[model samples]
Target: MPYALPLPLAPSWWSRLLARVPVRERRPRLRVVAAPHGGGTAPPTLTELYLARRLDMVRLALFLVDDLPTAEDVVQDAFAAVCRAYGTSLDGLQDPGAYLHTAVVNAARSVLRRRRTARAYVPPHPGAGAPVDEGLLLAEEHRDVLDALAELTRRQREVLVLRYWSELTEEQIARTLGLSRGTVKSTASRALDALERKLAKRTETGR
Candidate 1:
């Protein structure tokens, strides 16, 4: 059986966790092997998929986890798992893109699970700076937005980012997130309303 990559939250709440965090220095790019999409006869190879989709997948994972290294790790692990499960020939799979999308989402959930577990047991040391320091790295406006974003439920965050930033249609998002179209639509509506309220509150308080 294919490993089920269930979302940590319900489909209606497939949100992300954004924190005020420092951006890491850019890492060297992954070397991509060029391969043409197999014509009517064959499916595109995994190498082709990686070369084409790695950046986009990384961005998706980054949006979810809010950390570049963790996002990259999530993508790397997803690819490695697929390679292990299917070898180089992905021809038989119905939708490799969807499979990879599920993999990245599952991997990101695993990272967050571990992070939450670690935080439960480990207390911060005295005099330690915030795990994420926004003031030094982000402008006031950016910080306010992110701070407001952080207040949202994980599923709400996910819905908004996928809807707006990723520019996925409701049906596409439903498919990617294993949600019903109705659920996606309602969640996005509520999330938008909530985000607007949060931003407005912040603005009013700042003034």
Candidate 2:
């Protein structure tokens, strides 16, 4: 067995507990390496599957996070998790793509949550004047999109990313986020409506 050696023991409470305990997934390599897809004697393996889908994870992640670098990091992390979960048999997993998609979405959500927690409110002392913006702001549509995205609530952001970037239907988005289909639809509608307003303002002000 891939787990511990099958010890000959009579059926009992202790044995049942040991059997039910899950196997801990090993930490993936720092850099991912997929198994060989085509070889003389060997067959298609999980490693090859991993490499094939790595690019897809990156693309799917970008629409959710809206930052290419961050998205790549997220994909890499997700891949690590997937590889860690890889079993020698690859049984019971009817759809690896579904598994990867769910993992990436969860990882992205975790990243966003950590960012928010890191931003816990800190009051400024009397002498600490508001920090000055050293003129890094650029005038562009991408910037406008960034601003609009930042303004959205977290759920709105996720819904928009799934609907537009991932091209998922409301039912799919809802299933991914663990929300109702109606909620997903409502969130996307609100997010898009707000983004349109922001774009309109930018157009009128020439900013």
List model 1 lDDT by residue over 28-129, tens digit each: 343333446743444457887787678777767866776666778999999987788777777565666778877887788899889889889999555442
List where candidate 1 sits over 4 angstroms from the true fold. Answer: 1-41, 124-143
Q: Give the RMSD in angstroms, all C-alphas superposed, for model 1.
A: 9.3
| Full-model lDDT for every candidate | 0.67, 0.59
Can you give the lDDT of residue 104 in candidate 1?
83
Give the poorly placed runs of model 2, Cα more than 4 Å off: 1-45, 121-141
Number of clashes found in candidate 2: 3
Per-candidate Cα RMSD to the true structure, in Å, reads 9.3, 18.7
Error of 2 at 200 (Å): 1.5
Candidate number achieving the greatest TM-score relative to the actual structure: 1
